[model samples]
Target: MLNRNNLKVWLKSVSLVGALWVANSALAESPEEKGLRIATERKAADKGWGDSIATTKMILRNAHGEESVREMRLKALEVNGDGDKGLTIFDRPRDVAGTAFLNHSHINEPDDQWLYLPALKRVKRIASRNKSGPFMGSEFSYEDLASFEVAKYTYKYLRDEVVNGEKCWVLESIPTDRYSGYTKQIVWIDQSHYRPQKVEFYDRKRSLLKTLTMSDYKLYLDKYWRAHTLSMVNHQTGKSTDLLTTETQFRVGLEERDFEQNALRRAR
Candidate 1:
């Protein structure tokens, strides 16, 4: 047992195993780390747009196949280190005309939302507890309309899957907000451009509630990719809503004052 040759061989084997173990450990990546990296990259891909204005037509459909159209104008201002500010002014349908919705999204905090009802002629505060409710009878909830900040969710990289012929990374994002309507959301984001192809929202009971599919992506300002066609379908109620952007202009000289609730009341 004390022979020099035998001792040398034993030491060599042990050294090799130790070296391999170190290499493998260094190469391995945790799912949480990878998920955060992917999400951060996705967010980084859509930065540097000072402001934007878009004209969108919302098509609401019932289970009975009837459709109603509402035209709206959207204005947004980018905020650094926080979520953006948005204002939606309804312009069509005599009943909903002059109605406005104001939102100021933030990171790691409850969003500030207000709705101006034309009939009431008074702005209604949208409480955090009520954010899970539908927005104007649409499939999307008030919380869903807020800007998606990275810190709002804890992400997990599930696996790679093909979505609508495009290979994408299937990511599971759990909302950190306790008042969020959904238990979790699964998103299929394309690996190439980091654009989301589809998203599935789960209800409080962990049941699938709604699905949103984005298509017809067009690049704005040669940097940001905007989906012109957004279709959201409710699996529970069999209702659907489509938002078609008729026009979009970036760097529209908009400022924070334009998104204020006072300005919304005056403009409407």
Candidate 2:
């Protein structure tokens, strides 16, 4: 009952509808898959920043508004097939001077961390269970300082929103480590650069515990991006800590040996 022209028109419409359906199906991304993809892309973008040395100032503010400041230097070395290693050496504050902290991050596993106390002349290993504790009386826990690895958390894409006037993708990440201090974290990552703008940490009991905001981002080596200021606020305690980076040098040619435990003791 169909003429040649009519048959051709009918076939074209069916083909068009079929193509559209296929395109829509291909475009649909599950929240979990989308989250993982974003995290992977972010991690990939930050790769190959060989090594770095940074001098930072730590400002601790108590609930009463009292403040104390400490100066420190950090050295970091990128590792292959694993997370990076870092060392933090304190230089100011007579009581805490010569103190050092060493960290070896691992994906989806408990990190190896140590704190070298100059007064005791001994290095204390930070137990996985205690990683949730405060870092030098600051709002940042030991776990909070670990280098982010994609496998460390299971992520879900929450939504998209504007943060600090920049469009961002909101994600919820649950820690994979049993000893992690935070049960989950809600993160806001800039859509353009994949840089984290803010993160809200939930305690083991799933209560909102702290919020960390990173600002003043600067690009280095035409590739890497770094935040000049990081502020962590404790919701329940009304306390906060601000980390201000005074200077940073990348591609310092640091080697793996420099991050060894022995090197932690000899850190200047």
TM-score of each: 0.87, 0.89
Clashing pairs in 2: none
TM-score result, candidate 2: 0.89
Q: Indicate the worst ten consecutive residues by lDDT in candidate 1.
A: 127-136
Candidate 1's TM-score: 0.87
What's the residue-level lDDT of 200 in candidate 1?
Answer: 96
Compare the candidates by lDDT and give the number of the best one: 2
lDDT of residue 223 for candidate 2:
93
lDDT of 1: 0.87
Query: What C-alpha lDDT do the candidate models reach, one value each?
Result: 0.87, 0.89
Candidate 1 lDDT over residue span 81-162, tens digit each: 9999999988987778989988888887777888888777788877655478887778878787777689989999999999
